[model samples]
Target chain A: MASPHANPSPRASRSNRATTVHLRLRKEIVSGHYPQGSALAEPVLAEHFHTSRAPVREALIALEREGLVSFEKTGRTRVRTIEAKDIREIMEARAALESMAAGLANRNWTAADTALIARNIDAQANVQSLAELSRLDIDLHHHVMLRSGNTRLLQLWEPLRWQYEAYLVEIFKRQAKEDYRPETDTIPSHRKLLKALSSGTPAEATQVMMEHVLFNMTWAN
Target chain B: MASPHANPSPRASRSNRATTVHLRLRKEIVSGHYPQGSALAEPVLAEHFHTSRAPVREALIALEREGLVSFEKTGRTRVRTIEAKDIREIMEARAALESMAAGLANRNWTAADTALIARNIDAQANVQSLAELSRLDIDLHHHVMLRSGNTRLLQLWEPLRWQYEAYLVEIFKRQAKEDYRPETDTIPSHRKLLKALSSGTPAEATQVMMEHVLFNMTWAN
Candidate 1:
């Protein structure tokens, strides 16, 4: 007889299997397809992903480390519940990390960096909905981290991005019926930061960046 | 014939099985027992832990999330190499986050808080050896983060303690033979910080904390 948790036959190229499984499960979790506190069994996930339990198990663990899931020492596996406090904590961390990134980007930015930021700003300006605007906002922050030239900073902040994106999606979906503006005025501050970077005053840039981050945090609240 | 990656027999308890495997493997990777870039096989790890591939697989995935290992599509996992750049980025982030935590701790600290900090400082004063001193130093920082009342900050900085510990141990081992009294002298700064916290001047404490972090960052150089 086959084992209760027998491995599924492999169905995909192994090279991208992990990434594929990770993305699929991540999307399911973030999109609210999987209700909070749902059980995520390894054998079940493997069957869903058409892969062995090995990769699916790894994906869930990755999600746990990313603060997207929690685990307990039960005989079976389960998905952890997301709490408001967790969301708040993630927001606070994002504010601090992003503020630092923005400040560093301001201080170290070149003309080319300014040009890239300008393009992002323009793209964001053209976006109509809060969802589009939020995605652009993420891209803008990513641009800053990339320009800041801090690889570790980027890595430290990367895991939080998915959660942030989920939160943004949730908030935007709730406010979809309301009139939402594109936040075009925030571009002026970004421009000022660019000026500070060009002048080589990281301190001033950092202050501006702090204000920018605080502003976003308040908006989230 | 038994499959190469298949478990030959079943286990009695699977709950502690995963945690036990995870802790053992994490210890090996964290202690540098596994050489960097060394491949970690699921079957091999399962056999060594006297468990099935399921729990061992889960542990490896968790390790990957912690940056202790990297999984590739080639159906193999390896210990991640710690790069100088990675260290530097982590330090930069630590500097910013810890500085913020210190500032908040200072602002919110009551007389009781001051007493706790002072106690830790006094404990550090009695410690011998650079390693013990380093451990106390981290404990002090952890205490500060806890006192800051920012749960998010604590969670964000949690995983980083491992990297910090590893770096500290390496640096302390190297500087043990040399006269590094100046580093020890920095202890007084912690005292000064406590005084600032008692005085309710968070700005001053934040400045001092930033300097303290920057000072530690210089150690790796």
Candidate 2:
């Protein structure tokens, strides 16, 4: 995580700019500022970022890979609409990857790692809105995957983060419309997963993590 | 599976050209014509393919994604040198995904699927060279993944194919130098895996597939 202010080589600077643009655009999409099915015009985004079209175009390609956006038949980019089947597929993929992450993390667990997860759970307990909680949930999974120390595993898990966030936003919105809270106690599940990673062997941690992730599929049902 | 002779739409024809160039270039690299660390110059490839640079560049990018070629510091693409560590990592990844694929495949397995896997096993038994056997080995796993009925799982398995082939070439070369024919019977493992997929439940199939894939790691020792 290079500091935003770091003045590196020209090539590094260009990459850093791309990363910054990608994150900002991803945030806009995840925050629901970019509505589903809305066009993300390259020129408009380049102007907004105060950068050339190159980085914006690269960022959009990354977003498409992350399942946040798609190129329409008309050769325009738009925010992807989340479908019920996409949600189910996302949960299934997340469970497989995160369970593997949990096992890998357990092999190299440290006190600091456990503490980070604990802090995430505590932060989740304090969130007043589903959106905040959902963001924290994404962070918790990211933390565990990062802790796994397998670069390829982390790369495989990266694209799923925003897909999960987008799904969360859609689910919360539907819940709000219905005036009903999700029945699952997501906080407890996170805490249980953290505890399993801390106190149990890799196999046990993997089992618990898989169950925690599978809970999302039940929510979809 | 479209025939090369098929007169399709212009766009489809362009895509088919790209695929043809990609496969031809991949074969040249895998057959050791493009030695490890040799530059894959875009213009040279375009000339070789008798096409414009666009499709050749696209093919190079696809090869890069497959872990066969990588961009060097000189801003030129070259063949990637597969390391022993890469072999280990590739095997680890293959095990994880193939194990999941086996489970999904079992959930949707038909007698036709079982027969197809059995045929793969029989084909493996008939291979006269280590290279041929290695290819059939890849095909066997590919068949299982394609049968998994999970598109995401199949996408995850796609890029690993050529990496496995490259690793096989390296391993076979090393073994040839040592005058060592690997004592382990890889064919029996495939046979057992197919038998498990044919008769066992998903969990049982998953365990067998994991064991089969993990056998490669033990070979490294």
Candidate 3:
């Protein structure tokens, strides 16, 4: 008898396939390929993934849950539109989550974890492109959450991943549009945050992390 | 011809029905009527709600998105099981979000807003049941978020509502099991938080809020 799933592999899990498709779609949306408010057609996605509509639909629903997309009453979906207010709210939310993550990381930091984060920060200072810079920014924050020894905190932070990507893209785009030169002063805050994390006090680390996360609130200006 | 929606009301919006059902179901799940890891059958819930399966499924999806439930690959849904690690993560996330909300509230606080929050705090002083206290606790935090004038912050805070309720219930349950008396000193921190909020400085308010939130980490003793 044949399997009932849209795409079935003996060794692969059903969710992994859906996740792969979801990540691809999320990347497209975050990278601005499927610009804000653009319709995401199910059949087209299914064809692109070389699968049935079931997995495509599942991917869309996952993205919808993450605030990267929205569905209409008629079951049609579109990328979520980012507004000025959303940008502010996203920053505020990041400040809270990342600051908390930093405190937890301080409480649970291992020598290896500190070295890993320091390496990311060092690489961050020499990133080649805006996209790489954006990825390193995410990497540093994600590493903090991972080192926090709190899996739930990381899970709570998962939904906002696309928002982080969207925000970074917006920042780089705005700066480029204004023909502004790259700012080198941003790394000092990260360096200070690293110093605070090594301070062995949760309060100190959290305070610096909160301020650093919110520091870019003035970036658009 | 009849409408295809679960509640085919000419006046009631489909989304409104979903919201109503969602809120009720969330309350039930949070209050422990629908225990963690319990299966949520869609058809039965639809019949209970006196509607088609559409709205019940929609409500379930919304709950799932909120992390209150999870859907399996077999098309079955179950309440998420809260683990010890999850509790810690949830508390950390709450501290971050609420502290940020407090800072935002300080920036946007009005005389009327202060009056409203004060009333909630006053009510908190005399709450008769753990359930009521939990509700009031949520209400106070929610009011702060509302006063922040950031709708996105409120939306971001919504998914963690059930976790807050669960944490409160766990605290109360553990205390009861130990036949412990209530602590009278807890109110002082809240009072201090209120004073800090009214201190007219964002840094002062944010610092107090962060400390006040993390104060409970040692409360179980």
Best by DockQ: 1
lDDT per residue for candidate 1 within A1-221, as digits (tens), equals 27856643563423356668888898887776766677888888888887887677667666776666666544454554544555666666776677677667766677887787788777766777777777777787788778778866787787778877766666555566445566546567666656665664677766676677667666676
DockQ of the candidate models in sequence: 0.42, 0.21, 0.36
Ranking by TM-score: 1, 3, 2
Colliding pairs, model 3: none
Query: Model 3, residue A9: displacement in angstroms?
Result: 7.3
Per-candidate Cα lDDT values, in order, are 0.71, 0.75, 0.73
Q: Judged by DockQ cut-offs, is candidate 3 incorrect, acceptable, medium or high?
A: acceptable
Any runs in candidate 1 off by more than 4 Å, and if so which?
A: A1-15, A35-44, A72-87, A183-185, A198-200, B1-15, B32-44, B71-78, B81-85, B172-175, B182-184
Q: Residue-wise lDDT of candidate 1 within B6-80, one digit each (tens)? A: 552444323456768887888777666766788888888888887778788777766665667777755578887
Query: Per-residue lDDT of A5-101 in model 3, one digit per residue for the tens?
Result: 4434433433566668988888888887777788888898888887777667667766777888887875578888877667777777777788888
lDDT of 2 by residue, B94-137 (tens): 77677877887888888998887777777766667777767777
- TM-score, first chain, each model: 0.81, 0.85, 0.87
Clashes of 1: 1
Error in Å for residue A111 of model 2? 0.8
Q: Against the native chain B, what TM-score does each candidate's chain B reach? A: 0.79, 0.86, 0.85
Candidate 2 structure quality by residue, lDDT tens digits, A152-214: 566666766777777778767667744324234877777778888999999889889888887
> Which residue pairs come into collision in candidate 1?
A106-A197
The DockQ-based CAPRI class assigned to model 2 is: incorrect
By DockQ, the candidates rank as 1, 3, 2
